[model samples]
Target: MKIATFNVNGINGRLPRLLEWLAEAKPDAVCLQELKAPGDRFPEAAIRDAGYGAIWQGQARWNGVAILARGADPVETRRGLPGDPEDAQARYIEAAVGGVLIGGLYLPNGNPRPGPKFDYKLAWTERLLAHAAGLIEAGVPAVLAGDFNIIPTDQDVYKPERWRDDALFAPEAKAAFQRLLDQGWTDAIRALHPDAIIYTFWDYWRNAFGRDAGLRIDHLLLSPSVAGRLAKAGVDRAVRGRDKASDHAPAWLTLRKA
Candidate 1:
C-alpha cells in the first residue's frame, strides 16, 4: 500500500492541483492538512469523482485535516485530538484504510514566540504526546502522517540560523518531535535517506523553491508493526513547482504486501 501526506495550504483554492496529483500519483491512501474550509464546504463529490473516499474535519479559514482511501471509504476512527475539551481546531483526523491506521494532523505553527499561540502550541504537543503513547501501546499497525510544522533538525532546514527564533524551529517544538521518535516511531524519510537533504515545503516568497531553500516539515512516521514493511519513501518535489501549487509537496511511503 502507498500512503501520502500533503498540506494543500488551502483545499478549495488548490483543488485542481490536488486532483491532478491524485490522478498522477494514485496513492492508496492520503493524509491532507490545512483544508482552510469548513466541513460543509469540503468538496466531497469532486474528491469522490477522482476515485477516492474521504473523511474530513474542517474549520473555517483555518486548520483542517482529512484522510482519503483510493477506491474505498476510510473507516472513521476519531476526529480532533483528545485531552483538551476547551480547545477546538480541525487539526487531527484518524481512520482505517486497508487494515492500516492513519493518523493525519496539522500541528500548530505557533508563530510569534513568547505569546499565547506559542503556549497553546506547546500545550497541544503535550496532549498529542499523551495520545500518541496510547497508540503505540495499542500495538496496531499505524502510520502517523501530516504537516507537523516542526523543523526537526538542523539538517532538515536549509538555513537553521535564519530560523533560529521561529516557532517551527523552536527548541521546544523540536524536542517534542524528537520525543515522538524516541517513542519508537520511525521517521520514514530520515531513516531511509539519512544524509539526503529532502525538503517538502518551500515558501513562495524570495523564490524559495527556485533557490532550493526549503524545509522538511511534513512527515510520515510508522509504528513498529508497519516500519518493517516500508519499501520506499520520497517527496514529490516537482509538485511544489507547479503553477500556484501549495507551499508543501507530498511526502509518501510504500508498504510491502504481507
Candidate 2:
C-alpha cells in the first residue's frame, strides 16, 4: 500500500490540480490538509469521479483535513483530537484504510512569537503526543501523516539561522516533534534518506522553489508495526512548481504488503 499527505492550500480552487495528482500518483491512501472550505463545499463528486472515496473535516476559509482511499471507501475512525473538547478546528481526522489506522493532521501554524497562536500550537502538539501514546500502546498498524507545520530539525530546513525565530522551527516546537520520535514513531522519509536534504514545502515569495529554499514540514510518522513495511518514500517536488500548485508537494511512502 502507498500512503501520501498533501496540504492543498485551498481545495475549491485547487480541485483540478488535486484531481490531476490523484490520478497520476494513484496513492492507495492520501491524507489531505488545508482544504480551506466548509464541509458542505468539499467537492465530493469531483473527487469521486477521480476514483477515490473520502471523508473530510472542513472549516470555512481556514484549516481542514481528509482521508482518501483509492478504489475503496475509508472507514471513519475519529473526527478531532481527543484532549480538548472546546477546540473546534478542523485540523485532524482519522480513518481505517486497508487495515491501517491513519491519523491525518494539519497542526497549527503558530506564527508571530510571544502570542496566543504560538501558545495554541504548543498546546495542540501536547494533545497529539498524548493521543499518539495511546496508539503506540495499542500496537495497531498506524500512520500519523500530514502537514505537521513543524520543522523538526535544522537539517530539515534551508537556513537554520533565518528560521530560528520562526514558530515552526522554534525550540519548543522541535522538542515536541522530537518527543514523537522518542515515543517510537519512525520518521519515514528521514529513515530512508537520513543525510539527504529533503523538503516538502517552499515559500511562494523570494523565488524559494527556484532557489531550492524549502522546509520539510509535511511528514508521515509510522508506528513500529507499520514502519517495518516502509519500502520507498519521497516528495513529488515537481508538483510544487506547477501553475496554481500548492506551496506544499505531496510526501509519500510505499509499504510492502503484510
Candidate 3:
C-alpha cells in the first residue's frame, strides 16, 4: 500500500493543486495537516468527489488534521494525543485504513524559543512519543505521517546556520525528535534515501521555493512492524513549484503488500 502525507496549508485555497496531485500520485491513504478550516466547512463533498473519504479534526484558520482513504472509509482510532487533558489543538488524528494504522499530525511551530510556546512544543512531543510506544507495543503496523515542524538533523535542512535559533532547529526540539526514533520507529525517507537532500517545505518569503531553499519537516515514521515493508519514499518537489501550490509538498512511501 502507498501512504502519503501533506501539509496542504489551506484546503480551500489549494484545492485545485491538491486534487491534481491526488490524481497523479494516486496514494492508497493520505494524511493531511493544516486544513485551516472548521469541521462544518471542510469541503467533504469535494474530497469525496475526488474518490476519497476522510475523517477530519478541524479548527478554523488554524491547526487541523485529516485522514483520507481512497476506496474505503477510515476507522477512527484516536482524535487527539493522549496524556494532555487540556490540549485542544486539532493537530492529531489517527485511523485504520486497509489494515494499516496511520496518524496525521501538525506539530506546533513554537517560534521564538525560550518561551511558553516552545515549552508546549516539547511537551507535545513527549506525549506523541508515549502514544507511539503504546501503538508499537500493540503490534500494529503503524505509520505516523505529517508536518512534524521539526528539522531532524543538519542534513534535513538547507543552511542549518540560518535556522539555529528557530524552534524547528533548536537543540531541544531536535533531541525530542531523536527520542521518537530511539523508541523503535524508523524514519522512512532517511532509510530510503539517506544521502539525498530531500525537503518538504519551502517558505514563501525570500523566494525559497524558487531557490530550492527548503526544510524536510514533513515525514513518515514507521513502526517496527511496518519498517521492513518500506519500498520507496520521496518528496514530490515539483508540486511545491506549481501555481497556487502550498509551501509544503507531498511526502510519500510505498510499502510491500501484506
The backbone clash count of each candidate, in order, is 0, 0, 0
1-258 in candidate 2: lDDT tens per residue?
999999999999898899989989999999999999999999999988898999999999999999999998999999999989999999999999999999999999999986999999999999999999999999999999999999999899998899989999999999999999999999999999999999999999999999999999999999998899999999999999999999999999999999
For residues 1-258, could you state the per-residue lDDT of candidate 3 as single tens digits?
Answer: 999999999999999999999999999999999999999989899889999999999998999999999988899989999998899899999999999999999999998798999999989988998999898899899999999999999999989999999999999889988988988999999998989889999999999988888999999999999899899999889999999999999999999987
lDDT of 1 at 29: 99
Worst 10-residue lDDT window, candidate 2? 14-23
Order the candidates by lDDT, highest first — what do you get?
A: 2, 1, 3
lDDT of 1 at 197: 95
- Candidate 1 lDDT over residue span 159-207, tens digit each: 7999999999999999999999999899999989999999999999999
Q: lDDT of model 3 at residue 251?
A: 98
The runs of at least 3 residues in candidate 2 whose Cα sits more than 4 Å from the true structure, single-residue gaps closed, are: none
For candidate 1, the TM-score is: 0.99
lDDT assessment of candidate 3? 0.93
TM-score comparison, 2 vs 3, better candidate: 2
**Alpha-carbon runs more than 4 Å astray in model 3:** none
